[model samples]
Target: MNEDELFEALKATLLKEDREALQRLQDILDQPEKLSQKMSPVLEERLATFKQAFPKEYKGIIEKIISEKLANSKEELLEAIYPIMGKLIKKYTALQFQLLQERIDQKLKFGIWHRIKTGFRSFFFGVKEDEMILNELMSSTIDNIFIIQKHSGLLIASTNNNPAHQDDLLAGMMTAIKSFAEDAFDKNGAELEVITYDNYQLLLESYYSYYFVVAVNGNISSHQSAVIHEKMNNFSAKYLSRDKVKSGQFSQALSINLKSYFFTNPIA
Candidate 1:
């Protein structure tokens, strides 16, 4: 045997196992299903182990990385997290308001004797009874006011602290809801008085001609509801007319009056 043949023999002897392994890997790669079958169990097992150990083993590393990233990219982090933070805050606030309302309801359920005794104590102690009562009640602020035609659901007048789109749509929906509830329940002469969601309450006061829809943010007490009803009645008496509503004539003066009545002062 010459030098070339001897070198070839040596190379083959040294590289035979590696060459076979490479061929096998190439074959597996060419057949994707076979590759997946071979990898599935290994990948799953590794993932399971990683999941089991992750909190203990990688907690510090992950925290460190997050902290570093937050510190370095504060604006980007804020941009990414702001919406989620807002949603969380809104949810938390709503839950808190619900709890507060429940507490108020429980307090208000006290017997007449209890209230009389409390009133006497308040008088003797020189505590402002009105203020004390108000404080105990759920505080609310009026956000939007709408006057819609009773039967037609036409937007008669509206005023909102926040600019809103599609006032007509809201008026129509409110009317639809009122109509549905009245028809479904067949509650004669009993109209929809209030609609509530999350942290907002809508107080509806229906009249002969038109109705008032007051959007209040926060809990509205019985007293507040009565006050709103009185205000709406007065407004209807002063301004709203059946003929005007029927004629589809909405008045800017009515809008101004509503804004003046509700938005001029802080509603409690």
Candidate 2:
């Protein structure tokens, strides 16, 4: 055996072992279940080790890679993240709305303590107690009053301080807004009570045949709201008969009566 022959013989032996190993690997690869069984333990071990060392070993690398990708493909990254961002924004907006509603509820909750405190302050200070209480609790004024036909959205009667008021247009608009709000919220027989804008508010009191829409200019306390509601009930009971209202028999007499009633006892 010379040098070349000896090298060739060693190469052949190695080649045979390599072929046998390759054949065994190919066989394992062909059978998916067996391959999974063999690979699972090794993969699990590797993953465990990676998880253990990830913070120390790969954290900086991952951050750098992400930073680089973001820097290089800013628009692409934003596009990918846009949907998630929108969903997050919508969720945040909804949460904010709920928080606002809760805050309003808190402000509106006039407990016994509040009444007592207000009463005591009024008694001691010798100020106009009723006015002071109204100021402290809620300084509201009725800007416009409307008695609207429910299904027809007809203007039964209305009164407002504004001389430039468009009664028919305002009535239609108010009815549309009320309808939209009720349908959108789907409150299951609950009426849309308050519609608020910058420094203005509309308080709605719904009834069977007709509804009362009172536009107010400030915060209305619970007591004040109840008083107004009671007044409305009285008005309805005394003047607006359901049959008459439904039959479109709301005459000028009834309108004049409504105007007189509200004007005589104005809500401040």
Candidate 3:
């Protein structure tokens, strides 16, 4: 049997034992040690059940808890709760893995990442694809689209659809970021960096001391920002495919950070 089966079996047994333990505790309030005495048998039985159910996976899980070499905090009261908590964690993890497995299977079959990239490309190019992606993303409650590149400036894309800084401001931001990117790439060859911009202003002209602004816009969702990254990655990938020596290091770094956000909140 798989881990899920083992978890379900263990959970059922634990639930029953929990109920019984509570009943016994209610009956023997005067003799609290009676509850402690009864817990050992239940723990042993559950472990035995797990061993029989998933013999291979059981040993590691059991050993980790046993090897912790720490005293149970409630040993004098409800002794089983400590072990039960551990078992519950394992059971919950098993269920989560099962669900994620199913999600991956379905998504992988349909080339979900590829499709997302395609959708993102449309958004960046300001075409039909862009409308679909932007519309869907704006509908969501996500705000603040942050796009960052290590050694480069930050691109703040938003749904405000404002062209306030369409020329000079954008030029200054790009120049500042490009300078940083060139310097870093020249030094490290391949390096990773992360930066954030808490606020900004209308004047495109400013002394960029610590970091520069690459692109600026109004309110945007986390989802739209991710789509932008995905498109940029796809764009870079295609370029790199043609010429292996292309400097896609910045794109790759941004994509890595974007990936963290995507995984945390997909379809958002």
Local distance difference test values of all predictions, in order: 0.74, 0.71, 0.43
Alpha carbon RMSD to native, model 1: 20.0
Worst 10 residues of 2 by lDDT: 78-87
lDDT of 3 by residue, 83-122 (tens): 3333444455456646645664565458777567855777
Candidate 2 residue 45 C-alpha distance from true site, Å: 99
Query: What's the best-to-worst order under TM-score?
Result: 1, 2, 3
Candidate 1 displacement at residue 32 in angstroms: 99
Q: Model 2 over residues 98-208: C-alpha lDDT tens digits?
A: 665565556446556765776688789877544565575587777778888876788787775454797657877888988888888887866777788987878776667
In terms of lDDT, the poorest run of 10 residues in model 1 is 78-87
What is the per-residue lDDT of model 1 for residues 135-251, given as tens digits with 9 covering 90 to 100?
Answer: 645677787889898888988889953446677888899999999988888866678878889989998876665678999888676656655665666666566555657665566
Residue 96, candidate 1: C-alpha displacement in angstroms = 24
Best by lDDT: 1
What global local distance difference test value does model 2 have? 0.71
